[model samples]
Target chain A: MADTMISEQVLAPIVENRAVAPDHVELIISSAVLSQAEPGQFAHILTPGMLRRPVSFSRIDQENGQVGLMFQIVGDGTRWLAERRHGEVLDILGPLGHGFAAPDPTKPWCLVGGGVGVPPLYAAAARYLHRSRPDVIIGARTADWVLMAQDFKDLGLDVTVATDDGTAGHAGTVMGPLETWLQDHPDGQVFACGPTPMLAAVSAACEGRATAYVALEQRMGCGIGACLACVVKAHGKEHAEYRRVCTEGPVFAAKELIW
Target chain B: MVIDVSVSLPRGLTLKNPVIAASGTFGFGPEYSRYVDIGALGGVSVKGVSPEPWLGNPTPRVWETPLGLLNSIGLQNPGMDVFLQEDLPFLRDQNAVVIVNIIGHTVDEYAQVAARMNHEPGVAALEVNISCPNIKEGGMSFGQDPDQAYAVMKAVRQVTDLPVMVKLSPNVTYPGLIAQAVEAAGADMISAINTLVGLAIDIKHRRPALGGVTGGLSGPAIKPVALRVVYEVAQSVNIPIIGMGGIATATDVLEFLLAGAQAVMVGTVTFQYPKRMNEIIEALPQVLHEYGFASVRDAVGQALPGRAPIRGGGQ
Candidate 1:
């Protein structure tokens, strides 16, 4: 099963690196090998530290051979990545992991993202744009924390904003907007990427109402699945088994997840 | 002149080079096949496989430290059946020198895996991993005690005529005692040292960073300790030693060889650069020449006390 997904390790030069939002940097790197990356897949980037930081593809430009990665500076690794300048070469291994499966054209779809998780959903929205306009709900802690709402709007996606502080669109968590979307479109398919609690909430809301898919984040090593570092609980025939997030999925159907 | 890097262990196990992919770091084989030529490696000590499918640990199995990686993956594997059916054929096809690293929760379980792998056509050797720090039972426990370590090696030796290398744990007070015990119990060779037990705190969560709490630390942080263990164990036992712990370059490999290791396994460094082992192998000859060594064999045990004087003035 592992024979099919072939990934390349390339040295990509940063084409553009800038702060896209508060405490968030968007890094666009030019690599012919990684430019073929799909939505929801990620690049395992080498940092100054020991381990590689796994960042999802925020934007994939197949035509120009560029892939953009947007990440919040939560740790030393991301901080090092943020410090990289345009023209600086970064060692990148990608387009890794099983990405979000293409939505059925006949079904309505909604792309829900929270904070740093918004980037991959943006990539998903871009991929699904040719088929149909998906409803995109962008959520964050506050107005300053919200990301890529305008970019979704630029893509002509039906965008909704939610913040915990009520400093932006809808008040409360993304659950408010997500619940309303599920109620309005019972048959809609939901695709989300966010913190564990947010993803759990999204998965619970979609239960028996819509088919949901989620992208998971975990501390990883050897992003190629050799180290067995990034695994998530999965339902099995007898009991719960661990699945490699770097291989079986960074994206999985909500039903397959134990959470 | 071509530098000879080949290694020959007891029971007819021969490697074309001294750089092997350590167990747990490299999965069965296919995980890094996309980036690495499987046949080009000296050998691959595949992830530890038990008799039955093991569930391993819960979420947050790994944490990064300064120049090290802490992992409590708990030896999760698809078991011997899945390995023979799914993983082995791929390695066999690649013509890889396959060293099956076997582990179990009990002495019987260890014997069970050994007996099953005894007849495998493409297997080059069996690396008995009694030193995995992650598992709750039968891992570090077996390697920490001399009697238990002797029993496990003896049981494995009884089950298979295959070349058996018992992996030693560095967490023990005296790793050389366990090494000597295994050698006495009929171990063909030894691989030292397993990851050192370490911990990381998730200050944000106010708890352990890894799900398994304490994890085995590997990478550059543990190299000095590994070198110390290999140097100590080399003085205690006559069996060939396969040394591993944060080996990243050809220079590191030479350090292991000079410290009395017959071969070396590259683990966590592969996580940083998947092609590192191959690169190390390619660079070994020039590195050996620069260090004034005629061959990898000549370099072994040069740093040991009372060994012959440093040759070629390359130190």
Candidate 2:
């Protein structure tokens, strides 16, 4: 059998693993491969029992080839992974899921994220910060759910925050603050990542406003496309045809996306 | 390293290993080739398709239990146009035998699909899956009724010079009757025990696990039923047998071989582990070596001690 994934066991030290904002936990896996991965991308991390967990590529060390993955423990697989030691080799399949696209050098950019979705924004933000930092807004359920606030601040991007409980930053989903900012910064392109509901909300918010790309989520079976298991209706399609979440995208344009 | 193990049907079709990726489980076979070589398989039975396109059953079409999975995919596939235009080119590149499995509502529909497939260059055989209940008349009924099974096979036999393998439903009360009917009508081979009729109650969801209400159950759970069915069908028919229900390992492949299957098909396993077919193919030869057989032909019915060869027993 042809091994499509060139795999190697890696010992990723948990640089940080804690409830950043309640149930969500951001893990900066210490590895050289992380650096080679781009910002809008992700890693297919093999959890202890979960088989393979696709986490957002929050950040990467391109020169060192290391990357970071962040996720919320939603099921038994995540629970099993959470019980690992700080220094451990978590067998993983990586750089999975289409990450956010890099901004055109001449064009302005905007980034919007929700809760767990915020992690994918870091890599995108880091890339553009070299010349010009993009405007960024992240939403969370409550003040406590706003993770990686300090990390975003460190990236030197024009960052804004929104929380439903109003415990921190502007209170509400990222859309309220993001819409206000985008209306003023009309020229900037948009990139977003979040749960389906959150992405849907943002997609609606960005309607007819900005060209936005969304990282869609579905209950994936084989994070590779073979199974045709995780398929969703493609937008504007007559047949109600489906697209594979793992391959064609865990990412798509908010406008091109059907659901 | 796992040993190379594969099986081919009695007709001498070359399979990489005996572990075939089942129809409906491995979509068109090309998609899985990216992760693992689909060509290195005993073969890949493409998802069941009809003359016209099938929208298939509604969602909640699949659910996982403790160790098994229930599915009512109803064989959702792009019609023959898509198959020939989009899938065939890619499938031709794959090394495995491409067994184009056709499904239909009426006898004529089956003829039409087989006719199209018969002319296709890369396809090695046409597997007529009569187990699907989604069709109008000749689907599950064609499998359960001896007369209907013979009629469908006769129509297909008349249309194509290509080899035809009739896949039987495990839901039948008399699988042997259906086997005999197809054999009499000139089926080249038989793939025994399609998903047995099964249902699961979603206690938490407070309804059935599938939107189809009743779905086919497959996995490790159904292997025994499939084995028993293969055993019975093998003794009853002289046509070569392709046995598959819930095959996962090489040893499991042997169980079907001994039960009278000339070759074994693997379904449901790839759904759980995408490269599981790889594991079986890689280790199958070692499995054979362990069994002290020079070639798979010797191992075919070795599992069925005294299950004598009969008229119309094999392809």
Best by lDDT: 1
Query: What 10-residue stretch in candidate 2 chain A is worst by lDDT?
Result: A1-10
TM-score of chain A of 2: 0.87
For each candidate in turn, give its C-alpha RMSD to the true structure in angstroms.
2.8, 4.3
All candidates: TM-score of chain A: 0.97, 0.87
lDDT of 1 by residue, A77-106 (tens): 999899999999999899899888778788
What DockQ does model 2 achieve? 0.22
lDDT of each: 0.90, 0.72
Off by over 4 Å in 1: A1-6, B308-315
Q: Name the best candidate (by TM-score).
A: 1
